[model samples]
Target: MMAALRRRDFLFGSSLLLASPFFMRAARAASPRIISLDYGLAQTLIEFGTPPVGLIDTPGWYDWVMEPPLPPGIANVGSNYEINMEMLQLLQPDLIISTPYLEWIRPQLETIAPVKSFPIHAVGSSPYPHIIAATLELGQIVGQPQQAQALIDRTERDLLAAKAATRRLAEQKLAIMTFMDARNIRVYGPGGIFQDVLDRLELQNAWTRRTNEWGFSDAGLADLIGIGDSRIFYMDPVPADVLAGLAGSPLWQAMPFVQKGHAQRMASVLMFGALPSVSRFARLLAEVKV
Candidate 1:
C-alpha cells in the first residue's frame, strides 16, 4: 500500500512541474511594459511598483516632482507636448498611460501602443479618490494588488495624522499661490488639489475667487490684498532676482499678510500630483511654524 501511494505522489508532482511554464507565460502577459506620457501617470506607475519603461520630460519631472526618484536608465521619451515617436517605437512599450489633457493625441498614441487615459482632474470630482482608484488600477495591471492596497492604507493613515496635527490651524484661513512673475501669481482655489488637501486637513482656503478648470487663477499681487489676516504659502522655484525684486517692491511689502508676518514661502510640491505629493505638502504645512 505504501509503495503504491508513493508512486501516485511522484506522478502528481511531475505533472505539476510540466504545467509550470504555461502559468509563467500567463503571469508575464499580465504585466505589460508601461510608458507614461506625463509626470502624474509616471509617478503613479512608480508608486505601484511598476516603473514605466520610459517617460516624457525627465528634467521637468526632477524639478517639479522630486520624490520617489526615478530608477537608473529610464529612457526619455520626449517632451510632454512633442513625444519622440521614433524613440517611443524603439522602446516598444505594451501600454501608454496618459491623461485627458492629451485626448487630442490619443489616436496617435494608440497607433504606437495601447493608450489608457485616466481623467484625474474631473469636474465635480475629488482628486484624492481619483488618485486612489488610479493607483489600484495600475497595481492590478502590474500584478501587485496587495502592494497597492498597502500604499493606499498607509497614505490614508498619514493624511489623517497630518490632519490631527494641524487641527489648531483648521480655524485659520490659508492661501496657497505660485509665483508666475514679479507682477502675477497663480492662486489655488476651490476644486483644486491643494484646496482638496486643505479641506482634508479641516483647514479653510482663503482664496474664494473663481478659477479655471485646473483650479488656479492668474492674478496680480493686488488681488491677494483681499485675503486679509491669513497665512499665505507661496510655492518655490522663484528666481532669485524675482525674490530681490519682490523684496524691494513696496506694493508686495504692503500686503496685509506680509505686513502681519503671515506670508511665507513653502517647499515646492507638484500641486497636481498624487499621494506622495499630497502627503508631502500636508506634513510640511503641519510642521511649519505659523
Candidate 2:
C-alpha cells in the first residue's frame, strides 16, 4: 500500500511507456507500406484513408486528381516508367502496386518488393466491373473491406444523384477532350472510363469514332468540326502556348460548339482513373450551367 504513490513519482519507470501520438501517426504512415505506380490505383488507396507510402509523381497528384487531398510523409519515387531505384530501396515498401500499362516493368518492381497489378483496362472491356473488383481486392490488401463496400455504395449513390442533377443535360450530346498541344486532341469515346461514366449517367457521347482500349483517339480541331452542335468539355491545364495557339486558330473559333457557345472548360479530371474519377466526372457534368 504505497497509498497511490504521488504522480510523477516513477515517471522514468512507469508501466505506461506507450508511444506518443506523433510517433504513432508516423508508424501508421509506414506500416504495411504500399507504393502505387498508377494514379488511379493510388486514388483507391487514398479513398480507403491509407495512402501509399510512396507513389509516382506525388507532386502532380493534386494537379490531376484534385481532391481527397494526399496525406503527409509519402515519398516520391519518380516517374511511372522511370522509378528511382535508390529511392525505392530507401522507402522499403511492403507492397508495390501497379497497372497493366506498366506490365513491362512489373518484374523490376518485384525485385524490390511484392508487386500486385490491379489489371482493370487490359481486356478492352467496360471498366466498371474491373474497378469494382480492384477496389474490393485492394480493400482486402489494406484490411479495409467494410470501407471498400462503403466506398462502392457511396460512388453509386453519388452517381445516381448526379444523374438526377443532370436530367436535362442528358438530352444533350457531350464530348470530353484533352488537348495534346493546340494541334492534336484526345477525344474520348467508347471502351474507356469516361465513356463508362457517360453511360452510367444516361448521357450521350458525341464522338462515336473508334477509340483505343484506354478510350480516346488523337484528332485535330478540323476533325471535331464534324460533330456539329455537340457540347464540348475540354480538360484544362492545357499548355499555355497551346492554349494561345488555339485562341488564334480560325478553325478553333469556327467549330459548331464554339460558335453556339456550347464549349466548356472543365478542371483536369484523370480521364483514365477508376471509381474516384467516375464520381468526379459525374459531379463536374452535373454542375455545368449548360
| Per-candidate TM-score against the hidden true structure | 0.87, 0.88
**Model 2 TM:** 0.88
Please give, for residues 170-259, the per-residue lDDT of candidate 2 as tens digits.
Answer: 778999998888788899887788888889888999998988877788898689987899898989778888777766789889898998
For model 2, the stretches where C-alpha displacement exceeds 4 angstroms are 1-31
Residue 156 alpha-carbon offset, candidate 1, angstroms: 0.6
Off by over 4 Å in 1: 1-30, 122-124
lDDT of 1 at 17: 27
Native-vs-model 1 lDDT?
0.77
Candidate 1 local Cα displacement, residue 109, angstroms: 1.1
lDDT of 1 at 170: 78
What's the CA error at residue 228 for candidate 2, in Å? 0.4
